[model samples]
Target: MVYAPIHESLPGPISPSDRIESIDALRGVALLGVLAINLVTEFRVSIFQHFLPAALPASSLDRAVETVLMLAVDMKAFALFSLLFGVGLAIQFEHLAANSRRALLLFRRLLVLLIFGLIHLCLIWNGDILTAYAIAGLVVLPFLFGPRWLLLAGAAAFLGLYLTMQVWSPPGLFPSLASIQSNVEEANRVYATGNFGEVLAFRLREIALILPLHIYVFPRTLGLFLLGAFVWRSGVLQKPNHVLLFTAGAGCVGLGAAMILLRAGNAMAGTSFGVLATPAGTILLALGYGAIIIAIASSARGNALLGWAAPLGRMAFTNYLAQSVIFGWIFYGYGLGLFGHLGAAEALAIGLVVYVAQVIFSGWWLGRHRYGPVEWLWRTLMYGTPQPLLRAGLNDSGQRAA
Candidate 1:
């Protein structure tokens, strides 16, 4: 059987009209969390070393900060983003009558995203998720029409394989102290003083490092995508299904507590179980976060405050790229040459300030425009035609106007 139209099967919250505000608010939250966790990489700090305080001789305050980040922000944000990506795909599918046309459109959209991602990776930042998402999107497209049971099974199987790899891998696989230090030094040297070519070379090396980990990461991402599609198809996000909401919220709290316990024990034992536990915990937490955000946005009082995030979410593509450009300028040699100078706390503070500015700017821009500049460009390329960037009036069809 073909996938049913979302509007028919889940006609409440997932309705096109009301969907944008809540989803955008949740996305905005995820963006902030991603920025917070990305500070370690931006500062050229070894994440492993930061977590294992003995490796780096971190201060108590630093360790405390890292603990908070690890337990809260790290994997959860990306999971939220991935889930949202799947929801978006399902939403698109709901509007298309012909599967062939839908597939073609999705392929073009992903192709445009891939091009943007490659540009960002090569010239801007190496920690690009867009490329990976685009790649995963292509893989996930065929499965969109699969039954919910099949999707759930696929998610479970892939997640199981990822966890098995994490648990079965020998501790000796961990990078040596010398290797970590050398890599850190090399990254700092290249990013702090290198020319454009040198920076590109370093980025290539970084991409190489990502290649090996994709074995686990790619499958995990696919699993999350399938799970997200399943969630959307099930109508949980479309309506106030208290049973699903309670289940997800309970799962999040339970998994979060378990993650904290695992981390504490790992810290004491000088081992890392986060590779396996963090993903599971974060997935649950991401679902819970999405459900809670939708619930809040549905309310009048909550909307007054959280509605601000919708604008940021609408411009997520633009803000995502802007973060890389602005942060690159702040840290890279070609700009401010401040690489490795700021500590985690300082970097986090700066990221927050930048995000706030983006919120204000995005709201102002969307007030007069149909889409963010980059988003407009992406849609133009995807659709093979120019789109209207200007909002005509309060009756404009774009969600920003609504």
Candidate 2:
């Protein structure tokens, strides 16, 4: 079923010179979408409120915006990010010479990421995906060496478990308006007025809430990772073609549309159907988005425009942390204390503005440096040695010695 050139006979791992620009562009795009959804949380709004009618009253425009975002952005963005992480692991595994070496490196990488996630959750923000990705990375490690069918089966099993839980789980336990309002009020009070210690305590409580959902979220994340690995093993991304890209893009969009229609009659905010369909639709849409971005990046003019994202993508680790730091200052008590004051539309606008600025800053930094500051640190820590940071004479991929 693979539609690209096979790399079975390749001599060694793909060099940095062989980096995929489309993947980078897609990651950059996913980052923006992630920020879109995260803005709601950062603004101290209860995302559960979107599902519960009795929570804080939102403006009609806010509800409309939330609906649009739920349909298009929410889970889809994170799914894309998860897929990319798997693709990265696959690429790294391909490049390494030995399984032991690969495992060691990956373990180190994931461990570092876990630490970063903890820091982010405890100090910067409670919603950190890096920790989840790290956990999922561990969950997916066993399948990396297995056949493609085995990986697919594992993904299917995980997804099936999630669906089953959603179908049979009691909907009554879903967040009530009273509960949602209480949490929102507490979050606003702590985040907008509390000291650092108080903020940390509030974040820990939020993380505690997230822990129970890992039963579903972890498996979903692992499944997407395996799917990404499958894509890489199939050699689809390596040999991007117009026909394949179009078909993938169209098929995913079609599937997502169908799923959305299935749940159209129900209020999607907190219903079981919403739980199942939302992720399913978003997963399909995210695939379609990846395909479309690949198509665009394969073209000349489109590639030129999308290339802006490559630098941003390359520095994604740095930019992601930067976002937490910057947004924390803007919205939290220690800084501007603007929490609970902004609407969906206003928060989204701010996210876009910040993203654009990150893109520009990423480009400027990459032009002078081999890697983003945090990326350099990450590599250094993973390898237990100093990694080059300057790019005096290095090439675009920054793999060449300066």
Over 4 Å off, model 2: 1-16, 54-60, 98-100, 170-181, 267-275, 393-402
List the candidates' TM-scores in order: 0.86, 0.88
Best by lDDT: 2
Q: Measured by C-alpha RMSD in angstroms, how accurate is candidate 1?
A: 5.9
Query: Model 1's lDDT to the true fold?
Result: 0.73
Question: How well is each residue in 342-376 modelled by candidate 2, as lDDT tens digits?
Answer: 87877878888999999999989977887789988
C-alpha displacement of 85 in model 1, angstroms?
1.0
What is candidate 1's lDDT per residue for 1-402, written digit by digit as tens?
A: 222232332111122244557778888888898888876554445333342334532466656666777776777788889888888877766655344456777789889999999998878887888989999888888887777788788878876776677667545545566666666668778888887788778877777555445555777788888888887888877665555676767777677658756765775244446655655666677777777777777567767879989889988999999998888777777878778776666777788899999999999998887678998898788766666577653232232232
Q: What is the C-alpha lDDT of each candidate?
A: 0.73, 0.77
